[model samples]
Structure formats: C-alpha cells, structure tokens
Target: MTSEAKTVQEYIDSLPDDRKLFVQKLRDVIIENLPKGFQEGMGYGMMGYSVPHSIYPKGYHCKPTDPLPFMGLASQKNSINFYHMGIYANKDLHDWFVSEYPKHSSRKLDMGKSCIRFKKFEEIPFDLIGELVTKVSVENWIETYESAFNKK
Candidate 1:
C-alpha cells in the first residue's frame, strides 16, 4: 500500500518489522549503486530516486512541479515493489532485465510494465537490482524519457 510518510526515513519507519530490513536493504542497495545526480526523496507516496530540478529543470512532464522520478520502492499489500523508469523507457534495458531475471532468482519474475513485484522479500535479487540501478545514469534517463514521452 502507498505510504503517507513524507520522508524516506518516515516511510521506512512505517513498515512492519517483518518488512523493515528487506526494504532497508533494498534502499541501501539503490543508494549505494545509484548514479551521481539522482536524489533520494519521497514521491507518489513511496521512497523515490529522482533527477532533481537542478539537473533537469523542466521536471516531470506529467507533474511539472515534481522532480523527474527514476526509480521507486514501495511496500505493497502483498509485495515489495521496485519501480524503474529505465526499463519502461528503454526496450533494450527491458529485454536485458527480462532475460537476466531467471539467472538471479528461481521464482518467476512477477512484473508489470515497470514495476517488479517481490512477493517473497528474501527472494528479492539485490544484486540484480543493483546492476539495474547502475544501467541508467541521470543524463541517460532524461534523454530516454524525453525521447519516449516528450514527442515534439
């Protein structure tokens, strides 16, 4: 479920004890591997990593006042979801992740367009997620986002 927590720490604090560690570990993996220019913050009621306005002043096209979101992590009702915009915007990245998922986990990939659902917290592939985080830099994400969504 979406969190009402305003800050990343608040969001983490709000999670049940069973989820706190997994979520924290995932957050740590993302922060450690995240490219230099994306900032960690709360967006869309979840913990978000985004390209701040200073980097891309236009902000998100759908919500101009908000920073451009790159990735997000949420503790859903039945799963902990990881959202990556790179896979949504780049076909090559999506295909690569899809092909590589089986190498990391025995469980079938539970995914939506950009949201990867981890029903079993212990089964979450932190290493794969870390690698995916590094696959797109802030500049690359902005270019990809514009090319995919900002048609002239």
Candidate 2:
C-alpha cells in the first residue's frame, strides 16, 4: 500500500516499531545491491528506486514527470511489499524466482507479478532478493524499457 510519505526517510520513519527493522533490512538489501545510476526516493507513494531524470530524461512512460521506476518497498496492513520492476519485465527472472523462492523460505512465497509479500520479517529471503536486484543494472533496464516501449 502507498503512503503520503514525501521522502524515503519519512516513509521509513512512519513505520511502526515492529515493521521498521524489517523494512530497514529490506531497504538495505535493495540499496546495497542496486547498481549506480538508480536513485532512492519516494515514488508511487512508497520508497522507490528509479533511473534518475538526469539519466533518463523521458522518465516513466505512464508518468513522464516521474523517473523510471526500478523497485519499491512499502509496509502494508497485512504484509511488507517488495516490488521489483526487473522481475516484472523479465520472464526468466520471474520464472526463476517463482521456482526457486520456495526453496529459500519454508513459508509460502506470497507474490504477485512483481510484488513479493512477506507477512513477517523472517520470511524475507535476503540472498535471493539481493540476487534479483543485482540481476540488471540501470543501463540494461533503460535499454530494455526503451526497446519494449518503442515496440509498442
């Protein structure tokens, strides 16, 4: 779920004590593995990583004023949401995660096309999450995004 948070710090600060540590840990993983050229900020009302407007002037296809989103992390009422655009756009990555995530966590891998949900902090698969984030760099994401949009 989205929040009215104006900054990443604000988003993190707003989380309750129970969820804050987990969110921070997840954020740490994303930032640690996130390649250069991707900036962390507030986007889609959640803490997000994006290709900076300076690097990709065209911005997001649906919202040109906003940077091209790479990933997002948020605390929801029921679960923590870890959103990955790389997984959403790439079939092999999605397939790999779907088939492999269960092995990493005994808990049910609650996921949508891109948003992986964890009901508790222990459910997060840090190694796999880091691997997924590092799979594509900002340059590759830009090229893939451009190619896909150009085709449309």
Candidate 3:
C-alpha cells in the first residue's frame, strides 16, 4: 500500500506465474531486512526498494530527484541483478565479502557502483545480502553513495 505501489500490483500481477512466485520470495526477504525508513518502488524496469526522499531529496547537484541508493532484486533479460550499490562503492567491503563468501555460496557478482548481479533465486545468499543492504545507516549510505555518485 505504499503509494509507490499505486497498483504496481498489476505490474507484479502481469508477470509470468513462476516469476511471480520467485519475486514474492525475494520481495519478502528484502522487506524483512531493508533498512528503516526505506521505501519500495519500481526502477530499472524492476521492483526496487530505496531510502525515502525525506532522507534523500532531489537536487543534491541540481538533479530533479535525488538518485535513490538502494539494494533490491531485479529481473533482467539475461539474469537477475541483486544490486548492492554499497559494496561497489566500498572496495574493502566488497573484497571482504567476496573473500568471505560462505562455502555453499553459489553466486558471482557483476558489480556496479552499488549492484551485484545474479541469475537465479538459488544463487543468492539472502541473509548476507540483506545484512549488507541494511548494515549501513542511511546517513552512511548517502555519504558513500554521494562520494561514489559525485565521482561518476
């Protein structure tokens, strides 16, 4: 019932049934671990969740809306992208994560300034990824995201 949904339900509804089931599980995991005050919405042609505008409004550099720094599951033509903007911005963090990937972990990352791409539900480590997404505070994320965004 987030205004962001605005009957985004129909969009979710429009998905193929198996995808719906897959997305619902992913959605539940993200929601369960998403940071406080973050909001859910669509982005990059996929379901995205991000920190609210109250915390990050437009025009940091005179842009229309502040780019949301988010971590969420995305469906892409070739793969599912589990974006982790925070990691891509922090080399140490990313290195530590990649180094510490658990024994059973089955995924590899196509990193972005803040994204980690994957192909399927079975490949993700929900607990670790969620912790990564929610671990940093909004203020911290903005600082990191700002530094990274500014560099771009």
Best by TM-score: 1
Off by over 4 Å in 1: none
- Model 3 clash pairs? 84-114, 84-115, 85-114
Per-candidate TM vs. native?
A: 0.98, 0.95, 0.75
Local accuracy of candidate 2 as per-residue lDDT tens digits, 1-152: 67998988888999999999989999999889988889999988899999998999999999999999989998999999999977888898899889988888898888898899899787789888988889899999998888888998
Could you give candidate 1's per-residue lDDT for residues 60-114 as a string of tens digits? 9989999999899999999999999889888899999999999999999999989
| Tens-digit lDDT string for candidate 3 (3-111) | 2333346546766665666667667777888777777776545676666778777523445474574665655565556777667677888877777666437555556
Stretches of model 2 off by over 4 angstroms after superposition:
none
Better of 1 and 2 by lDDT: 1
Q: lDDT (CA) for every model shown?
A: 0.95, 0.89, 0.65
Task: Specify the highest-lDDT model's number.
Answer: 1
Candidate 3: give its CA RMSD in angstroms.
Answer: 4.1
How many backbone collisions does model 3 have?
Answer: 3
Weakest 10 consecutive residues of candidate 3 by summed lDDT: 1-10
How many clashes show up in model 1?
Answer: 1
